[model samples]
Target: MNLIKPHDRISLAEKIGRPSVALVVDDFYNRVQTHPTLAKPFSIVAHWQEHKQRITEFWWIALGGKPTASYSYDPVSKHFLAGFNQTLLSDWKALFFEVTHTHLSPELASAWQQRVEMIGENLLRQNDKLLGDRGRPST
Candidate 1:
């Protein structure tokens, strides 16, 4: 018997469809908190809950492809400014992949993976330009 059952992609979409971006932020925050290296960076924010909501909204905007009336800060710039290196970025990607694999359907997983990879690549490029090759030193 196949231990892994197929997930309902429609159901997953529906679940993500409801409510505000807070859910995604909460999930991201939870993952960051549990990660050894991520926890410190995530803890830097004084208002974690608010930060989480903003991050969640950012993801929602990226995935949902909708217009965001609120928040004007750019996520890519924020992350780079946060002093994240390549290892931390890789850790973030790994955690994201693991979370999607465990919680999302195959279709959703594929979509998320593509989206994250694009974002990560862009961030890496931006970081390289800003801090030089010594900053991340790609691995």
Candidate 2:
């Protein structure tokens, strides 16, 4: 059996660090705010700075860094409320990949991108189930 467990492995948070993560989030969100398709969904975000900070923290913890602040991230509910359709999610993923690739090393970007795919897929599935039960897919 493998000696290193999932939690025991060196985290991407440690390797990529918070700075790079924050940089990507900042840049990506900036572009997203102005993006034709992305802008509409993101319009719900009241404060851009606050959103970036929280998202940066979210990614940091997701990549296995220790939490520096407490937060209750209800992403599925939020995205459902935001009316995130497949197109929006697809655009988000493409833009995110672009930003990460520009900001991080190829290997690091690939690693982080994989995690994003897994989480995003799960989010999409959960959001779809919830929204579908309500008799409509998010637009």
Compared with the true structure, what per-residue lDDT tens digits does model 1 show for residues 48-91? 77777676666777775455558877656667678777788889
- How many backbone clashes can be found in candidate 2? 0
Runs of candidate 1 exceeding 4 Å displacement: 1-16, 19-24, 133-135
Task: Evaluate all candidate structures by whole-model CA lDDT and list the values in order.
Answer: 0.70, 0.90
Pick by TM-score: which candidate is best? 2
**Candidate topping lDDT:** 2
lDDT of 2 by residue, 46-102 (tens): 999999999999999999999988977988888888987777888999999999999
State, as a TM-score between 0 and 1, how close model 2 is to the true structure.
0.89
